[model samples]
Target chain A: MSRAWAVSVAMMVAALPAWAQDVGVVSTEQFESPRSGGIIVRVGGYKPLLDDEKALNGKTPFKDTFGDSSLLLVELELQRYFYQGIGTAGVGVSAGYGEKYAAAKLESGVDAAEQTALKVVPLGLNLFYKFDYAAFEWGIPLVPYGKLGLIYSPWWVTKGTDDEVVDGIPAKGGKWGWGATGGVSFLLDVLQPRFARDFDSGLGINHSYLFAEYTYSDVDNFGKPGFVLSSRRWMFGLALDY
Target chain B: MRLTFAVLLLFASTALGQTAPVVNFAVPGASQGTEIVVSKATCGDTRTVTWSRTGTLPCSSLVFWLSSDSNCSGDPGDGDLVLDSEEVPQNNTTTLSGTLELKMSDALAATPNLSCDTQATNKSYRVCASTKKQDSLLACDDTASGVGTPTIVFTLDPVAPLAPAVPTVTGLDSALSVSVTVPGDTSQMKVQVVELVQSGDDGGTPTAGAEKVSKVQTTDNTVFRMEGLENGKLYGVFAYAIDKAGNQSDPSTLATGEPIPSNGFYAAYREAGGQETGGCGAGGGGLALGAVVAALGFWMMSRRKLS
Candidate 1:
């Protein structure tokens, strides 16, 4: 009777794999969604290198007035993947805004009643490459990307309600430059594979990721001796592929 | 045939028995139940009172008058002031029209018995009109029947509102910000700025210079910014509350501020020998770049759809 009970237990153990399979517990590699383009929403700290000019003679006017604080820059970038085989390559366009406000300084070096503000609108066009192949095939869930871009930043200074004018020149202009960015994204689908598949089927979103990037930009009109709007900053944001 | 003749005879008697004409009074450019503001600025302005009659009753004239009573019911020998007597000529037309021009000063002068010295107070009067038949005014005794009379209230506010509190002045670069606590009865506030000329002698008080700038705020906002001032100079600031009648109150206690030079970011950049001139850099280049990017995106989207 003990030998018969051992046989019954052995048969039940043999059918366990088949039972799990029948109950829809399948691997994520089976279901795949078509991939196209991606959208990224990012924010970063940006402070233009205004004191780097040689004529300033070691005087940090920007730091003296606004102090050593970085403005919070929020950016939105859109990329369309034209080639998407081993990796994805696309041209992206991004726009961002940042501003800093501080109490204006008087001629006596004291704080004034009115506020002075420095505002910037940064626009960029870039060609990007994302090595997302391992994420889809090997399920490594980490995608590394690189971007080379051209940037044009329009900046303005305001005192009170009007544009600040000094020596008959209005304080508003744009600077042109170039930048390079490198970032790594972590796939969110690996944490919740079933919900990720449902999201794909329901909202047409193929994948989602959280990413952080570092950018090195030289935005002084190709170093033509002007206001150096260049900066090196790190940005963190979410990325969505559809 | 006898019944038809009797009906015609009754209609003819009813038409002939109508002795008084129906009158309606309207003030041009003024809506119903709105108070008209009379001030020193508009003292000589005239408001036309139009009356229209709709009856062929052979009325001699239309008598128009102003009375403090809402019904215009008091005896004419008392406070009732006759404005105009427009003669109605005998004509074939059933509708008769007349206009009475009421000058604001004349209206105020006619009602001397009423108080006009209070701040923002309404002095009301009824614009009454009656059709005259052989020098006898019709419907003048019937106060209960409110048919042809329209009441118009005149806000004769000749007194100024209470002065505001002393202004709190802040010095800025080539400007001064002044704020005051407005009185409850104030409708508007005015801020006046004057530059102060300091005496060359030591410890002498600064004398007031010519008025530099004045700004009137018509909103409930009590803050004013006097701009275009010279830097490194002292200035006096004063605030006054104004009533709805355009009467300005006495100036508040004197407050002073000193404008100073303020350095902004652009100024700092220029001081650092930045070569970039402040303007649109490379005109139209930014716009062209945006257009190219947008076109490329649309083309890529269409290609995806085709595939």
Candidate 2:
């Protein structure tokens, strides 16, 4: 009996908010991150580029990114939220897959280009500010997104190391790649589907969403996928707003 | 870790036991040498029969009734060749026999073979059995002339079994044969060989007859002789048996056998145990034994400087 009462009290406390309803915008023009009150699967791709410093594009293939040879990137991220668009930003961590161009030479802090498959697994923390729509008809309900984070990408298996040579990769598994992003999201409000009832809450209901965001990482000249072997990811994501 | 160990112990306890044969030899009331026997042995579902070898060679072969009856199989004579014989003055040898034999892989290895041989024969070596005898690491003694390249050495002294003062010779059923019969428990006694010597009519003794040409094997408790030698000449005969431990018993009382002399040969060569141990009968033993002392070294250090 005590356990049941304790659970009820805990749930009530969790529902409390630090702030009230929406005052930001009519429609959420923010990137509705993959994060939601409930978990949803997401998979997609993006073309990455350099943005940090001139070094991000120096020995990296970033300059050639606008062309057809930019890069093919794949990514996946999972997240869950607590409140309805007004709580701690549950930054979703993701691992990205892509292709990079390369040459047999150029071994340095950046030049060691690997023209092979490249993959990066990063643990990240995204701080997105959630905003709810005005409790009226046909208004917006989405997360006003803005993310500034860092990912520790260890080029542990970066090519050329297996060719039986001293990779001068002096620093083996290393530091993080700093990144910043922002975007908009569109939600799907009312779909009945099957076996489930659509909430007919007299007010505006939450819906499925679509979003695209721009990113920039300091993966300048890691491999041969391009000059900027590691870069920003332009992604399209689908999410649900509760 | 405890759970893992417990699981392993449980599995091990379930496996059945596999044991071999043990040998313990005895030659009762031995005046000179003792005997040995593999009293208790286990041939469980295996065709393993036990046999003993002489000298320091860990070359005893086990015989089994069927190939599946024993842990080891193949040529009975193909015992492990011992090398690097070492001699540690071991004066005691306690034999265990009954149901199962213990693992002796390390018990009597090449080093022990060498050491024991040295203490027993004053020599160390890697001994190998050959057609003639066995080869050893220790080269032969210079005075050991006429001694072939390979030599055979028994584990005990009194090379010959004790002699019976009033030994009897009977069971003779052939023209040139007679048997050496034991008085008491003949189970442990047997006839091995028949040595024949010829003496001239003169008061002087002559080194008798012809060369001793015997059969490949002398069966258990059975001895045979080829008589019908040059007649009119006196020939002496003796027979004996060897216990499991390679200890030979005393020969029966010498009797007379007169063979019709053919050609100039009037005598027959004596058949006896073939162990030609030099002075003190200590055979020369330690030979080639390599000792490897491998020492691997690794060093790691750490330094911290606060600036």
Candidate 3:
């Protein structure tokens, strides 16, 4: 309909663009239909800077006053595609688990620090789309494309180390947020000797990709949504399509 | 006779050229305040003396004192030597070393318990001589009236407490049990745990989710929690042990664990603290070190400790 509307649609696809662009294969093997769909999964994590977590609120039961804890992230994306031959879109859903943690503070049990840990999870649904430009005619042998997705990360609840206290602080979980993401995707074939001739003859194809995205979340520290949490990152992953 | 003469000479030198005793104090941080340790507590061989006009205040310029109590107390011995009423000589740091051995008839006539050894709270005391007896006024900050009565510092018997050997972290997530064995003389020791994480090696561009392992102490073992880990993501765990007499050892080696890392921590805690009963399902794992690091070994079995 419109350029903005189109971009919004592209961001709703759930395929790991990096994977598809990096290792996946194209459907040059005479497909039954001009469409494709598959699954994408990733397990990874990151650490937040001291400055960022301090922004969460007052104090926490975490043993570390400094920024030392780390986060583990696991995600699942179910992707389905249509309209192939360089031009197509994919739709998918995702889910996963993760946590944050720190070690004990003091040596003695009396004034010692406790090893605090936090977990993050995406408890919501997702949708997305992508537009791939054919790699045939142009000198550019790699296929290039763009993507957009809408992620509804539901309220994340925490568990374990419940009775732990850091300077009289208890634990707290967070609310859900609507995340919007958009980025680029590419396809690169693996240099397997057996597939070389077939790959050059256009008989076989592989998928690989790189994508950058921005995610915004909501914060209800003061009992109301007053802050928006945001994270931006570039990821590399692969997905197969036929 | 010559040998006796030589021994005498050595003794005389030792007596005449004594070294100034070192004053040691503990600054527990600005929030904690300073703990002063006076040296050579006994006064020199003088009976009575006056404070010099020239010693700089370590913290502030204001100074005050009681004829008796060297302690920072508002109360002191009943001695109205009347401030500058009697100006003792200066250049007499030696004469000023101990308590002013002056008799106080007027002091006893007034406040009976006016000892110079009284101690006060949060106040610094110093002795100074001025032309006017009243000129020997106490100064608390720039305000002369704020100095509640006078205060002093007195020497106390030194009782040194021996330090205990350090302890170590014994376990992670799932009842981290920590065992600490100190010498018979060791006093109260404390223990704690904290989780940390760092990037793996970059030399070979290692894959994400790789873990970094730290040290642990375990003759037998010392454990803290059982299965209290962050899921999926890697972790760095640590511990510490301290003795009762305030002897603290450095933190112990760091262990690693991932609790339900597939799911996040806050989410799980919320579920646990709220709806789900110990929803931190038993699917977590730990990176155990060795038997020595009892705390480190628990990394393998991360079953839910809550439920």
The DockQ leader among the candidates is 1
Cα lDDT computed for each candidate against the true fold: 0.75, 0.33, 0.36
Instruction: Please give, for residues B1-307, the per-residue lDDT of candidate 2 as tens digits.
Output: 9999998777556332211222223333343242222111210111111223222212232221111111122321222322112111211123212121222222123233332223332121111121111223222222211111122121212133455343343212122344555433223444322334445667565443444433222335444544334434445555545444344556565565543311100000000111111111112110100000001000000111111
Candidate 1, residues A114-159, lDDT tens digits: the string is 7888899888899999999999888899999999998888888898
Best of the two (1, 3) by lDDT: 1
Q: Individual DockQ of the candidates?
A: 0.34, 0.00, 0.03
Better of 1 and 2 by DockQ: 1
Residue A227 lDDT (model 3)? 21
> Candidate 3, residue B140: CA error in Å?
99
Model 2: how far residue B253 lies from native, Å: 85
Ranking the candidates on lDDT from highest down gives 1, 3, 2
The regions of model 3 sitting more than 4 angstroms off are A1-35, A43-72, A82-86, A104-113, A136-160, A163-174, A190-223, A226-229, B1-176, B180-307
**TM-score for all models, in order of appearance:** 0.67, 0.28, 0.34
Docking class of 2: incorrect
Candidate 2 Cα errors over 4 Å, as ranges:
A1-68, A82-91, A99-117, A134-144, A156-172, A191-207, A216-230, A240-242, B1-307
* Model 1 lDDT on a 0 to 1 scale: 0.75
lDDT of 1 at A139: 89
Per-residue CA lDDT of candidate 2, range A1-242, in tens?
A: 99999999988777665223334333332322232332223443444443223333332323322233544555554333444434335444444444444322222223222222223333344444444443213355444566675444433222322311121322122233456777666544433322112331221223556677777655432232212224555667675443
RMSD of each: 12.1, 35.4, 28.1
